[model samples]
Target: MTRVKQQKPAASPAPAPSIPAIPKPDVPARLAALPGLPIGELKAEWRRLFATEPPPYNRRFLESRLAYRIQELAYGGLRPETIARLDALGEQFDGRNITFRRIRHEQRPIAGTRLIREYQGVEHVVTVTRDGYEWQGRPYRSLSAIARAITGTRWNGWTFFGIRPRSGA
Candidate 1:
């Protein structure tokens, strides 16, 4: 029998190295605080929308229901200047209490007439349109539409419907 030569173990290749994955912080939380639509884009869109669509509503143009009721009374014709002033009151009072009044002419019946004014117990002259709902002869959709024209913001509809108070009011 021939003598067997001692066999040496071959060096094993180094085990493959392992890599660790890095942890990442959550991103959605930070973005959540921002408005979904960018401010610039919203303004641009609003301008475009209003420029193309005719204004269907304007508080300055809408004759309140009370005003329309008062206009039906005797001696209802109003001067142009008075009409202009009353229209601007929406912007000033942010829609104050509206009222209707009867002015009976005890002495001069020709000059005396009923008056309808926004806010309680005011003598302001507010003329109502035939349908009693037009702004600058154009149909108005809501008091909020008028508010949008004046304030450049989306106002809640409840206020115009006379069902709810303004957000802060």
Candidate 2:
């Protein structure tokens, strides 16, 4: 009988260390829980989600930002086109300059809004238009002009109409 050298069976390769699959985050639940989380917990969550330190903002700000971040991570962020459009719009208002001058959209009422103000004993109605303001069927370039025509005196139109003061007052 020829002694055939039989090679021992090759040792089986060690199985890869079993890695526990990370669970998908439940976005809605996380968002809902943000409001109730304590400040320290909220900061912890912010750090975990953003991988950075939380901004030194108010509780409401942190909660709102974290909620947005949670949803963004789960469902993906804004589309590129949307982001570009937002940047373009912001540039229009920001002027892309160091001395930033923001156009106060909130202070200006929407076009077609009828501003009714009583001057002395008479009521005056000014209609906001796309180009400017329409007062008594006449188009005025500036609210101050309209205010002057209404009261025969110089006045800050926004203040006169009870709109919030300008950025620098």
Candidate 3:
């Protein structure tokens, strides 16, 4: 007959250190007044927050950006690495030196042009309109949105529809 000894149970883990909480900032009052603000006041507010000349954007653009800046200051901005990656991606698509204004002003396809792609046995069609793209008689902000609707997943509309070549093709 063999005798067995009882083993001791393992010890419990130490308590984790508590992290300090970051206090949220109050919402800027300017955000509420944005809709009615004139372009000059918006520009001045942009200068006050950013400490630089405001980009030559319209009133609505200035208001939205200033609102974002206020929130960004209260919270924090994207990490440096994230911003770097975004910059690299923009450079990959366009040149590193390319400005957004140049891209926005670039010519678009003629208003009457149509894009067609067949997926899952259904032919999807999109039309280029003066302001944006249209699909199935509904206006869309981007082809990606229409592609998502068709594929039930996110996709780069231009690449999915063959407007732009596939990565290797």
The digit string of per-residue lDDT tens for model 2 on 39-131 reads 999998877777778999999999999877777776677999999999998788756742233324455678898988999989999998866
Candidate 1: global Cα-lDDT? 0.37
Q: What lDDT tens digits, residue by residue, belong to model 1 across residues 39-139? A: 44433333332333223444322223213322322224467888889877643543442311111112111222222333333233322332223334454
Off by over 4 Å in 2: 1-25, 97-169
Candidate 1, which segments miss by more than 4 Å at Cα?
A: 1-132, 160-169
lDDT of 1 at 90: 48
Misplaced by over 4 Å in model 3 are 1-23, 95-169
**Which residue pairs collide, candidate 3?**
none
Ranking of candidates on lDDT, top first = 2, 3, 1
Model 2: how far residue 126 lies from native, Å: 24
What tens digits encode model 3's per-residue C-alpha lDDT throughout 1-169?
9989888898888765432222454555646777777788888777777767899877778878987877776688899999999988877765553332232324445677898888989898899886668999999867778999999999987678776432432
Error of 1 at 135 (Å): 2.4
Best by lDDT: 2
lDDT for 156 (candidate 3): 81
Candidate 1 all-Cα RMSD: 29.3
Q: Worst 10-residue stretch by lDDT in candidate 3?
A: 97-106
